[model samples]
Target chain A: MVTNEQRLACAYLLKVGEPPAPALRSFVSEHGVVAAAEAVRSGEVPDSVATETSARRHIDTAAEDLAAAKSVGARLVTPEDEDWPAWPLLPLTNAAARGLKWASPPLGLWVRGSASLEESLQRAVSVVGARAATSYGEHVAAEMGYGLASRGMTVVSGAAYGIDGAAHKGALNANGRTAAVLACGIDRAYPAGHSTLIDRIAAQGLVLTEYPPGTPPARHRFLVRNRIIAALGAGTVVVEAGQRSGARNTAASAAALGRVLMVVPGPVTSAMSMGCHDLLREGLATSVSSVAEIIESVGLFGEDLVTKPDSAARPTDGLDSEALRVHEALEPRVAHAAERIAEASGVPLSRVRALLPALELTGLAERCESGWRRAKEPV
Target chain B: MVTNEQRLACAYLLKVGEPPAPALRSFVSEHGVVAAAEAVRSGEVPDSVATETSARRHIDTAAEDLAAAKSVGARLVTPEDEDWPAWPLLPLTNAAARGLKWASPPLGLWVRGSASLEESLQRAVSVVGARAATSYGEHVAAEMGYGLASRGMTVVSGAAYGIDGAAHKGALNANGRTAAVLACGIDRAYPAGHSTLIDRIAAQGLVLTEYPPGTPPARHRFLVRNRIIAALGAGTVVVEAGQRSGARNTAASAAALGRVLMVVPGPVTSAMSMGCHDLLREGLATSVSSVAEIIESVGLFGEDLVTKPDSAARPTDGLDSEALRVHEALEPRVAHAAERIAEASGVPLSRVRALLPALELTGLAERCESGWRRAKEPV
Candidate 1:
């Protein structure tokens, strides 16, 4: 029942590590996925096989993975697939790519969710920042995510702590469609603490990755992952970052992808905001203070293709007792020592120290050299 | 038994003003001040006149002031005079007027000090800043003055308070040659508090003014005055300024004159520092942290034109008891309210309020709506 094109397309997706190769994309565009898949299975066309060493290895691995994918309910969504994300391919599909050099061509993405990837990609925007973000940064990023999502745009961001989690939560709180792009496989969340949030995302939006199922997240992979986030969105906004933060990497990727790069400025005295100031001074990025500016900069207004989602009601689930105890001890603008936090939270010093680690891992607190500081600003 | 040439030259100095007109400059360059004055007085050459109304009035006025000047201790110094500020004419004489457009063509400068104007101009650099300056600003300006002057350059400034007075005092304290370009008449120190400082400058270096001996300082004249400050030096540096401070006006003059413009940066949270920050951001001025940067920026390294005087034991003779009292109360980084200052200094509140007016007039203190702050850093 499978056609020659479908077989070739399947082989192409299997050959590439993640996100299918550009040639495969071209193949899917020119011939249907079924015909491409058929060509790959029959070895009917010489061009169907990958020519480069890396591509060949990727293809061989993908072939093995594709065979195993069906058993795990995993499916390869090619550009020809009705469920494929159409929005991310806008750049690849547009005339802008005619004469540009790509730093890295994304293979077709592996995503899990019932929400349409193609529909979400049409209005997706990535808001990224430092993992150890300040309250000022989180507030700005949250506002941006809420505003953009309310305007019918799908909020896209890495599901990491600090600004990223705030951005995702902001969208979810607004009842807007959102996606979390991860470094690890979609099947396994890396941080372990954000499992509940990730599960929520999977229930409502989508969890996407270039890594195959069960692949653990590596530090190096996050850099490569950032490029996909940049390529997938119309623009990237850096909410807060230090001079050497990873958020700057995302901004650089956005620049390379010919996507708009925006940064939020903060008080100059704050060491954390220096990167944004440096970018503004160097004229590499424009300053964005509000979500309206982001939307205007990305030119996402007045588009009828994207539909706005209804707002989500507040979750009835409250913070656990330990979390509540820790939260109650936090004060704005004050750096609390771990011992002090333990004393104020009314928990044993050993237990409080352990809880502090968990709090940091979950993005509720930041570990400074002197002490642990409350990460989130109180609403 | 003054010769016709001498009378004509004296007349030209009186008629055309202390700084010569552009056309008069050309005429003086071609025929010497004496011949140009004769041509003007005799109406033999109307083509060289810059403005008919001004030239005729100047001719009549100069003929009288020339006679009166001879009665006094002052004497006319024409461009041809060995005592004239020869260094300022180097740009014009060398025909490098492209960047020096902001410089007025000096017909001649009147001299009062024992030192030669020509020799001093060869080593001059202007240090200017906000009249309502902060302590940090004054500190920087003073250091620059002393540092640059000690390195064999004459300190040139407007002699107004906060930074300018500090600069002049810094140069004076270092026993280096210094000049004060006044907006008012040289004989009348408009800000009466600086009478002692002006007198010292008149005795040691020179107190020069474009306006006649009795003209009071006018708001409109300062703009033209700033141009002379920009022109007379190899470069100008703004230490601090508010958004629309007159220091910015001086910087514009320096830029127009093609003089090197340098600015010192401060904490961005301070509103007074923002003007300098804006200039640095706009690339209108280079940010300089140390005195060496100023020296190198103006190319003052190679030539040993002006000799450094013995400044090791220079007396702090000019500061009066009242000025010293106000200066002693100023502390770096702390801005105190008038009541607090009065309490701390053991001065009556009424006396403190009264002293603020005098201090502000002398450029020692700046009045804010909240309180009085030190205009310049205390030495």
Candidate 2:
């Protein structure tokens, strides 16, 4: 069980060090959160750990931070919590273990919603793109969000404007769950314009962040926060991103974390889709056209496979080349002798004679008093 | 030398059997054209060969066909001719040798153009698509044709409406060479709407086909004729295609003939681009957005390679995570001691002290008497 002491230690540690704090994370892992928090408070931790926490270690605000979180209806979910999303964050742990320092798992998450973090993220897919997205891109993103959500999959995004906001709204419109991983504190809406949308998401689904309360959203923090968005989702779809959009950073993080990476194709002329096309051209991402395709790409093996789309079959769909040529030779209005049909089709007389009966059986050709002619249907 | 008798014999063989006639091709390859034609006329050939030519063998229109071709400014370019495009058609021969009967090389091409058949196809790229293409598809196709033609490359396509007509027109607009491989006779234009376009292609470029004079365009012949279009070009670009459009057949033939297959990406909502997307999704074709990409895909080894596109670089593009955090913590108007900066950034005081000097050298930070502050530029 997670004791009050452990929760307090986790809340303190969450704010004491900047995220992706590899050395501090290692120390906490080795010493346990309660003991590690005590050591840091007493200035008795290792130099490497001190480097990560020294600046904030002197200020102990565990009790006040917990109170502030409670005031906003946000709870600190630690590794000791029952809903810590351990499985969804496994890739980050694995990647960090493989020596990617930036992929270190979060110390704790500050979440402002009632849904279980782990449960909400069980089948989540991240849909992200440029803030300057085109109308077409926004349309695709919204449709994909709605489709995936209606199919019982949670849509995850950063809760910013443009593509992200549209995706969140789409999920909400379907009355489906979605999680917004913000770059700012859970109590604060960084864009200001999305304050209501953030509230709706928190009420209906989740509004999560790794930043402590009172911590302002910084430029570098968004990049750091993207790792969480990428890790929480089973797959990442770049709906439409400019060549240097932050979504591309999320995509790269997703790929490095071993998450299924997908890209939606748009007009080659659209500058917003340049990053997506580059990813496809480099063979680093799969091309997904619809929600089903996205699911099929990231779903369990053989579980969510999409069927090959059916193309309308033509009347002469399965005819062999020779039979088709013979059928083409037959005239609809004028019935000609087998010799004339053979000459017109460039098929020998004997083969034409043999093929006529077969063609007639298929209702492609018919016999008249004059000779053989085409059926009413065109070739 | 291509003797008149040899030319006449090839003309008779060309009209005597439907193209892709494996048995007749083998007979002509083993026996000289003159002897093979004589044997076919006398009913002394093998049964297989007889099955291919028996119906038309009695017609004997060699002299009249030759006369008709000359009257329409067309010529019988036999295998014995110097400008037979042997290299361009080598893939058809190779594929046929590998047991692909439909890939049989043509015995003779009926040519109705002033350009040398062999020279015009030396560096050719086939740009083909649906007759019912969208405006966007047509625009891209025309641009590709114009770009390729202006670079001294021949743009090859069928003389149908939509993409084909746009491509041919684009090439002609540049006063560059192009070739039209028709399903019908060289003397006739299959789509009456494109008769003027066909005349222009013949006048300035080349109009070639294997079909004899007076042979009308049949549904099956378009498919049979696609093999030649696939062979004559080093690569084929599908600008746009419906799910079951004839362009898909051309794409298949191109792949079967071992030619580089490329498809232009379009909006997924477009039905005209469905076939191209399917090919891309199935990994059967490369996605090319520009003429440069197409050239890069089909160019010779170590030639015509495209460099990676340039993305705008940010000021902190190469900064490590720690440095970025430290930079973000620095204030623009106020300067504080390194300790304060270290605490805000969650970096060790010593590291912040070190990074400050380095950042100043890069003009990203400014040091005042009070401490360190951000430079005027945004992060």
Model 2 iRMS (Å) reads 1.5
Clashing residue pairs, candidate 2? A55-B343
The digit string of per-residue lDDT tens for model 2 on A107-174 reads 99999989988888998999999899999888988998899899888999999888898898899999
Query: What is the docking quality class of candidate 2?
Result: medium
- Tell me the lDDT of model 1 at A304: 33
The lDDT leader among the candidates is 2
Where is model 2 chain B poorest over a 10-residue stretch in terms of lDDT?
A: B300-309
Expressed as tens digits, the lDDT of each residue in B36-150 for candidate 2 is: 9999989899999998998899887889888888898999999888998999999999999999999999989999988999999999999999999999989999999999998
In terms of TM-score, the best-performing candidate is 2
Which lDDT tens digits does candidate 1 get at residues A188-218? 7757888888877777788887666555575
RMSD, candidate 2, Å: 2.0
RMSD of each: 29.8, 2.0
Chain A: TM-score in each model: 0.66, 0.97
Q: TM-score for every candidate vs. truth?
A: 0.51, 0.96
Which residue runs does candidate 2 get wrong by more than 4 Å? Answer: A301-303, B301-303
- How much of the true A–B contact set does each candidate keep? 0.00, 0.75
